[model samples]
Target: DTAVSQTPKYLVTQMGNDKSIKCEQNLGHDTMYWYKQDSKKFLKIMFSYNNKELIINETVPNRFSPKSPDKAHLNLHINSLELGDSAVYFCASSQLKGTDLYEQYFGPGTRLTVT
Candidate 1:
């Protein structure tokens, strides 16, 4: 079984459109995170949820939101999508210890294109 999976593998939308990406992990992990990888291939953490509680929230724009319905599902909603929001969004889950990570598993990623 896949440890982590994201839906809508590819998304294309015009500027100002709103879209959502869904992620699911079956690794029985308690901590999940969302990361954005830009064209330069730099990864930045956007949000982290531990046991369905908001833990680490980065300085992301208000247009971007992260929601965790349960331990295994995390969803991202983007409003007023801009050209700069065109990047690969990754969903990851790991057994977290304080500020450390263990056995982190990542989804293939959802590539978003804002035209």
Candidate 2:
């Protein structure tokens, strides 16, 4: 079974439109994160949820928000999308183990194209 899954692998929307991406993890991970990858493929953490609580809210735009209904699900909603928001958004989940602290399973990624 896939550990992490995201809906709408490819998203195409116009600027100023609001969109959302849903993510679910079946791995029973305590931590889940949303990341944005720019055109340069540089990944930056956006929001993180640990055990249904907001843990890390990085330096992201105010238009973006993350919502977690439970430990196994995290969703990202973007408002007033801009061309700059055109990039790949990734959802990842992990269980913190002393040895594999940074180990995470990522979804295939949602490609957002704003025009």
Candidate 3:
């Protein structure tokens, strides 16, 4: 079974469009997160949820929102897409906080291109 998966690995569209990227994990993890990797390859956490509870990281934009229907699935919804939104989005999961390494297993990234 796939530990993590995302749909529409490549998305291209003009500015001001709304798009959503879906994600799912089967590792039985309680915590899931959405990360944005900019062109410079800097990984930034956009949002996280543990047991369907939202945990906001202050640095992220309010335009982005994450919805977790259950512990196994977390989805990202982006509004009014902009050129600055072009980047690779990665979905990841970990068993819980304070675990050793707590290494995030990432899915094949969804690349969003806004023109």
* Model 2 Cα lDDT, one tens digit per residue, 72-96: 9999999999999999999999886
- In terms of lDDT, model 3 sits at 0.89
lDDT of 2 at 13: 100
* Most accurate candidate by TM-score: 2
Report the lDDT of model 3 for residue 18.
Answer: 92
**What RMSD does each model have against the real structure?**
1.4, 1.0, 1.3
- Clash list (residue pairs), candidate 1: none
Against the true structure, candidate 3 reaches a TM-score of 0.93
Tell me the deviation in Å of residue 68 in model 1. Answer: 0.5
TM-score for each of the candidates: 0.94, 0.95, 0.93
RMSD of 2: 1.0
Sliding window of 10 residues with minimal summed lDDT for model 1: 95-104
- Which regions of candidate 2 deviate over 4 angstroms? none
lDDT of 3 at 106: 91
For model 3, residues 1-115, the per-residue Cα lDDT tens digits are: 8899998899998999999999999988888889999999999888889899987554766788889999999999999999999999999998775863268889999999999
**How many pairs of residues collide in each model?**
0, 0, 0
